[model samples]
Target: MKIIAISGGSGSGKTTAAKQLQQFLGNDDCKILSQDNYYHDHSDKFSGDGSVNFDHPDAIDFHLMAQHLKLLSENKAVEVPIYDFVTHTRKKETIPFKPTKFIIVDGILILSQEILRPHFDFAIFIDIAEETRYSRRLKRDVEERGRHPEGVKIQFDSFVKPMHEMFVQPSRVFATHIAYDNNSLANLFEDLKKDFF
Candidate 1:
């Protein structure tokens, strides 16, 4: 099995790229493991005072994700966690995930984590202007995650941008390919399909 890591700043279309690659490779041959699901539950700690740094690498359960990756590589089935964005916590139930020919690990911090890096056979980093990323994030948070526009802006300024610069951007050196947008990602996919599949 080949493990692909798709890392980028929030709203840089990491998930979309992963899904697109999965579709290109066929659903039966590829599966996606989202790093968002491995976020450490912060429901009890959230005070709504902008204290929580969700973009930080510390916010993720990298060890558990690494373990799951190892198990999957060994052809073992695993129960992936389900996270609730609104509550900022993980749900009690988990979704069972079986290994496939390819696994795409999607997240902003996946490439930043040393534990998870070795699991990836190939890595991709999506690059975009900060303004574009912020705009996309604002729309997605407000529309899909039930976040207020003002709150999203505040968090983007306080946590997301800084963390992206500190953690996410530096990790770009680890990527085998860097995609600027969906079109580039598609082109890269076409080039990689024969090599990987």
Candidate 2:
């Protein structure tokens, strides 16, 4: 089995590509794990001041996530944490997953660290313009994620935007393949089909 790491900034459409790749490979043939699922669940510790800095690497339990990936690579069944973005907590349920031919890991900082970087058999980078990313982030956060437009801007300015340069953007240097265009559902499937075979 192969592990394909998809890395990009928020709103880069890497998640769409990962989903399409999974569908093309079929449910039994591939699995996807997202880094957001590793977000630190700190419902009790936070002060409700809206100052949580989630863009940092310390905001995740990468050690636990790395162990799970090792188990999956060994063909062992593992239960994954179901994270709730709205509540900033992991759900009570754990989802079982096993990869058949491949496991697609999608995230903003997949290659940002050397420890997590070497695990991927293939690394794919999704590139987009800053203007495009801001536009997509504004639309998606408000319409889908239920975040306020003003809050999004604030968060982006304070952390998210700067972190791209500090961490995420530099990680692109590690990618084996770089995609400039935002791959559509159909096109993403086709691209996966072309590569997997």
For each candidate, C-alpha RMSD in Å? 1.1, 2.4
Provide backbone clash counts, one per model: 0, 0
How do the residues 1-197 of candidate 2 rate in per-residue lDDT, one tens digit apiece?
Answer: 88889888888888888887787788788889988888779676544333666777888878878888888788888888887766778888988876568899999888897767767888888888888888888898788766777878887788788888899999999988788885444564566578778
Best by TM-score: 1
Compute the lDDT for candidate 1: 0.92
Best by lDDT: 1
Residue 121's lDDT in candidate 2: 83
Deviation in Å, model 2, residue 57 alpha carbon:
1.0
Model 2 residue 171 CA deviation (Å) reads: 0.4
What range of 10 consecutive residues in model 2 has the weakest lDDT sum? 44-53
Across 1-197, the per-residue lDDT of candidate 1 in tens digits comes to 99999998998988989999999999999999999899899999875545689999888888999999999999999999998988888999999999999999999999998898999999999998999999999999889988888788888999999999999999999999999977899899998898974
Q: How many clashing pairs in candidate 1?
A: 0
